[model samples]
Target: MKIIGNLFSKVLILIIVLFTLMPDASLVMAEETNLALKKEVFVSRETSGKEHQKTTDGLMDIKTSSKSWNAKSSDSITINLGAILDFNQIVVYEYSFQRANGYKLEISNDNISYTAVKEDSGIIASTERNFRTNAPHYVGVINIEKQSAQYIRLTVTEVLENKVSYIEEIEVYNSSDPDKFATEDTSLNASTDLVVDSAFGFKAPKVSKTIEENYAAGKPVFVSRETSGKYHERITDGIKNISTGGHAWNIKAGDYAIIDLGNAKEIDCVIVYEYSHLRAKDYVLELSNDMSSWTTVSRVTDYVSLNGETGEKSNAPHYYGKIEFDKTSARYVKLTINETAENKVAYFEEIEIYNKANKMPEFNAQPKEEEIKLSAPVVSESIPYSKEKFHIYLFIGQSNMNGRDNIPNSERVILKDVFLLNKEGKWEYAQPYPFGTKYSDYQGYNRYSSVDEGTKNGLNSASSFARAVTDNIPDDIGIGIISNARGGTSIEKWQKGSGEGLYEEAVRRTKEAISMGGTLKGILWLQGESCAKKEGYLDKLNQMVTDMRNDIGGIDDVPFIASEIIQSRPEGNVTIRKISEKIKASDYVSSVGTNTIDGLHYDAESQQLIGVRFAEKILNKIYGVTVTSDALLASLYNKEIQTEEIVPDYQFKIKINGKYLITDVEPIMHENRLFVPLRAIFEALNSTVEWEESTKKVTGIKGPKTVVMHIGSQNAYVNGVAVQIDVSPMLVNNRTLVPIRFISESLGAKVEWNQEIKTAYIELN
Candidate 1:
């Protein structure tokens, strides 16, 4: 029975041994399989060639003869070497009889096709003669994408004139084993020593007993030592040191220390300290994952200076503060004193690392959805003003219609003080503000207002009109001039339902003013320059009047007075005649003639005359007051009615290939036989009018070209080319009228007049 029991026990022990042996066998087979999968082969050419030897001092000298060459005549030297080899790297050395210019190094797989690997600059010839020596050359370091290469070539493109080139050495290294070609093991002490290349190794104090005692007592371990002749203390609170100057502990030349963070933590910052009085410098702080393969985090010179200036005296301690890690997964941190002060040592009192804060809370808050509503302005009902009691004039159109022509001075008439109601409902006087001022030489002629000339002029006119109308009626006349004008703006831009452009904004503002309290009386329409450029000028003008009348509380039929655009200068009579024709035909709109001394804008005298004409026409229709032309003439300093010879039966005849076409008119022949007032005539001719105040020129466009006729200048341009006309166009009575027949035919538009309808018409083919 005892023998049987002993045998059973032996059997059990054998079973346990076999189980352990089975795992070992499997592990060995697995390692073999892994090794077999990593197939790599290394090919080197050093052994077969003439061997060049180098000394232990890291320098080499090689000698080669030209007779050792296998020369080819195809302008390329091909080296067929290792077979079935995986090409990884190549190195070559060459010596020349003379200075070589350069050489192209190429690599190939099939020995036929080649790719240039590197181009090397030739070395200067050495003074040592007998077989000239050049500086040692490292030809090419290539990383081949494909693993196999059977042949490589070096083609010398340009060489120094009289030299024979001899290769001293060529080495090709390939690896079939990946592990052999991988980065060298740098974690060894030999590698570290090689990196430092110095003689010192670090040591530290014995703290095992103290650490064990602190762990038993559940308290932090403290290290106190005298370094650089000063006593320093360091306390570790598991992961970090809470005490100040923790990293400031000093150590001797060959001394080292370690701070165990107790557990793995995300390290955000690390601070270092030096000896109490001496500054620290030339040190390296590194981190490691497995207490090996350390990465240097920071290195700084003594007296940590950012701008390379020493801060030793600045009370700022010579320490590296807040050393951040690119990642937070490190377990061991190592600091090495690379170099230090000649007399003072390096030290670190305590190290600290912080984990980042939680960021998930910010992402958790989501805004609740809610209904939204868009608000729009409420249109108010219009308040009617009796014409017999009070008159409200709406000064509309461009800069001239606005009142930029009047100079502001005490000599000028002050009718009433005008104020603007700001968005906040505060009343602002029309005094000199930063944006608007006449005293600064920023006037109508300066184009500063041309961008929005009509708007600027409208504001000035409204202010002046307020002063003038208030002077006559006093308290009874609460003059409200709702102006809407944009300088250089065309009438088409002001059309309703054309999304709010500059002109639309003007019209909107005017309507808003009228809705608030402004009473409708007369619309002083002073715009035509933009319409003067197109063929359908009258139709567009008629459209604007119709649209504006419907928009401004249906005040279309309420005495709309049109101011004829003033001619620039030099030929004022011709422009006046053109303006007169339009005014004479439209009973609802009357012409306010050009009343300026210089002609660009209406002067004070002209402004008063314009006001009188507007008031007479409006008051007569609204109040049944008969305001005669004689009565209007009496108000103008009793100036005599300047009459010229009336051109009776004067007509324009257009013969296009012998087919007669009569030009439509209210092209009335004003005194001098000049057929004027043909908005339709100019429109049919495809001529556009643009007024430039700076040059005082009215420019006309035909097709892809321009013609500029200055007010005072006689020379004109046809498509930027200069030409002369018989009569220069001018501004008369606030109207820009040109000679009908002369300008019409010159612009390729035939002009003719119908004697039966008393009209002028233009025809274009």
Candidate 2:
């Protein structure tokens, strides 16, 4: 009985030990509930397709026999997870190269019915290449409320530019799983559709929004773009930790993320937490009563290294900074990013405005030296408001001068030495669409504003021209541009002191640009298209130049370079070129052919090239620098044409001022050289043509200049002076054909080509 009792005791102890060592049954079931979104388990199906079908059925392996769900005819795709699982997030991998514009996610326990979870619109395709994915890959994560779903559906509602759409892979994440997809309450201020750059994935800050709110109890502020997520809120939400992501604003220079106080409020101090990884440098803190006008309170230009200043890293990736001011008040605050510290991206974590509704000190009252020292932890010296010794150039003209080309990616970058007197009457990094459209009739002067007050805008050549000039000149020389061109304005409107018109506004802007000791170097004029067919336009142009030179400090002999206007029809081109010839003949006014595509306006590429020509003219005529060979004068705008044997394709479309020519004899391409019937094109251009049979030579006369070209020879004579041509004159189909450039240019006329349309334009001076 004792031995049996001892055995029972041992068994009882063993049972107790087993119970103590066993895992929690509830936890084991929860672990099984938290199963990862397995790719193999996802029985994927897609919208039907004629090609690349069954491709979206499995994993995103491109090497296998893959198929794609095309969005050619249909614009929706539905995926079934095949089993009920608790999930909240769906991740999709785009086709190897194609992308969808907009899509929405829906979930349902029953496949017949689904609930909408998340939707995004205007999502741009990924430009950065990921070799691991074998193409430009972008991942879209759709978040939903925690729920059990047997099926999930993805519907693409919009496509960009009708581009081919497909999905390489899809993933479902359980929202309840903390390790994979934790639900965070964050409200995004910037469009979430534009925020897919986090390929490495993002970890929402572990700290609660309440922590930041407690820190900003009294000072009130609102941001233009806010972070929208469960873990985040608008700028006023008092987000302090880097664990919570920041508010991403527009990345362009001079674009600001504004803070509205609701009304004019006095504020003396502000604390800012820049993005943990990316942040702005050389920014501005400005105050304003009306959003239209702003006063710069501080300019922060201290160079913060890529990871931020050493020892100042409170949040590892985030940099903490403070901006303190002499006590003042206003309703609106603006943080204008002049530049990014490292990347061309901008974002901020939190901002605290202190001394709410503090009354402003008396105006023009100088503070005691001791008062300035105690305002902030880091006191900054005020940046001087003057840009001394900068070289300023005035840009004025009609539509093409105002700009017609859309800004290309290559030209959108910022340059340090090149600056523009922005529409706001402030110097900022030069950019496209620099002209101010709206003029307040409040005063006789141009009190400009950078705000887009319903302005019609496009990219112009002035910025590029300034950039080129900046590239060629000494580094010490700052290049400034005053863009005053108004689209579709006539010469009469550009006359100096034309009483509250574009010209008067232009003069005001020019004076404002040179107010701080910058030298007015020259004027870049591209006009005459509006009055291309008007009589006595040359006289009007000459008078306008004379008036402008006098108004801008009576500087005689300032170089006024003009462009041979482009026109849709040949006759209009002839009429404008005649006037352009007179301007070119003037001592101060020079002319170069403005390259065009549609026969009306200079395309972006041509505008870039023409801007280079403008720079070349500036170098030669003003600075006396040699851009090409010594023989090619800097004043010569066609210096590039003289070097290259064959010009770019866009240089082939020709226009005479306001008209495009249609002739019975088409221009011929021989041995990579362009040849046209000498008589047909010239006669259409209003020039008298004669053929000398004895020498197989043709002589064309327009006004004072005569052009002579002989058959089968590249030698041509302009007013008795011999010049070399690209191609020799030839006879074909009983018509005499000559190298049009040589013949046309020799007669003091301008010739241009439109590469986009494959045509030529000729203008007789």
Candidate 3:
């Protein structure tokens, strides 16, 4: 009996000692419950520099120097007074540089020992200069993770060639563990507690709570709890240590404490903890950047009670709780404790603070100027067109097709029916020709015609010809004339794919037309001068025709017609013969010879005759009209032997010094070039024509007014003032072709170019 009593006394003593060292069981339970609470820390950099070190006052400062240090150097430098800090991340901010080169980062635990963390050989640490006031600076971010060091050093490997390297700032942060942190809570805490009932009717009473221990200085605050009373609340009013002004009651299973933050920088987040009890609803969290502006972060209403009796109870107690802010800028933070059930009370334990983080600057580059010019216009809707029978004609090839004649008069023709179909399937009608003439004939539309003043007449002539031919043809005939003709331009230009050359433009226009729902039929080619001047005339012509045919989708053995070039004079027959021979020899093309009084252009009669001839030969073939023989052409060329008396269709009567003079007969459209019979007109105006063949131009001097005309260019000079002519001047068959009617009438002379006899007559008015 004595031994058993001694053993029992020893056991009792041991139990007392264990009880003393174990601390209060309730306090241990409170700590265990709060351990599941989560925390976060956010750090932001706001300045530029290389070295960012914490000062004795705990404020961070960035520093930089001019000395270039090798970042890849094995030599080490120690940082003084370092601590063992658990840093999950480090971000280095750098400015713009031509290339990324020369930068190193090192960390050290002891002042005597160091470890190289990051050694980048091609890290350029420089801020780009902004010449334009609106140009933005470039920035780079260097992330250092899984690195254990208290002190960090950045060393430059190589200095930039022309620019200086700059670092804006560096940031360090400790990552938070989410599993260890609670995202929801059920206990009644002041910061996150929300009331739903009035069972424990607490009237407009402001309650407060304090968390006195185990608080990190710069960690995010989390909260979780529930409430029921009508008027219960708490706030964290600029007090980081403790809260006052609330009754300290025996907190039961669901009671809560409240904290109030006074006027300060905005509160980004708040935290709360429930010691042991469980509740059903979630917590309500609110924040304020300014005390006046309040934003509710979250509401906690759905929670599972971990400590319920059967693990299926509706409101069991829990320990861990957390609430996070959506990275806002704020100052004052507050919490409210709602009343619980009659016997239930809320519990509270911990609070934390998170500093506001900085944001990175955005960079967006601008687009180039040339690209802006090439952007196609937007089309709202497509025009309705038959997809089955839309035929596109691609008119490609040399100068004649390019239309290098004179500009037609404005009264010449109103091309109402002619239209160029745009990519959006919309039609754009051709404008009236801007010159002074009486031949206002309707013509088919021509696209991509030369705009140079000299080419207007030829283009107008072509238009008239096309209109006459297609008038009764298929309405589905969509003509896309990609006339990329340049005078004195060679086949090489089209072959070279140079700037604005006919080949590229032709291809582009053809593609555009086709994309707009037009099917390419054939290419109307009329170029050979360049090839004729050189040797490979046949080969070049063949290649050009073949390429065009292939590009236009190889439609029905694409037929090409070679227009026989007229002579500079009626006697220069060498070119005509060459053209005829080449056309007759080629299997894919037909030849149409035009009559020319001059070596350059065809007269109106010749133009009509040639058009008819071409229409008969090529159009007939296209229309299934087979020619039995080539005898008719031979007969027409050989049988023209009679000379008829030239009668003036219209006579110009003018008063020259009040004297009526019927001047000598003048040829209207002479040498394939239109001549104004300037001598008669000038004589009528008391002036004379001065010829300068060396300049390929003519000058008419009449009473201190000098009107100059060039053979191939659009602009003319009248008395030293530049005048824009509708049509370019031309020299045909040793005759200086001038705009007779316009010049004569404007210079006080009445003149006319007769259509019947094809002669020009002028008189001074």
Highest TM-score, which number?
A: 2
- Name the candidate that leads on lDDT: 2
The local distance difference test score of model 3 is 0.41
**Whole-model Cα lDDT per candidate?**
0.42, 0.54, 0.41
**Could you give candidate 1's per-residue lDDT for residues 403-444 as a string of tens digits?**
544233321222233434323222233332223332322222
Q: List TM-scores for all candidates, in order.
A: 0.30, 0.34, 0.28
lDDT of 2 by residue, 394-423 (tens): 877766765544455555555667666654
In candidate 3, stretches whose alpha carbon ends up further than 4 angstroms from where it belongs are 1-388, 406-411, 414-418, 421-426, 430-432, 435-447, 450-461, 474-482, 496-500, 530-533, 568-599, 603-610, 625-765
Runs with alpha carbons beyond 4 Å of true place in candidate 2: 1-388, 432-454, 497-500, 567-599, 628-765
Candidate 3 lDDT by residue in tens digits, 338-424: 433223443333344443331111223122122111122222243244534544545545545544333333214433334444333
Worst 10 residues of 2 by lDDT: 439-448
Q: Weakest 10 consecutive residues, lDDT, candidate 3?
A: 34-43
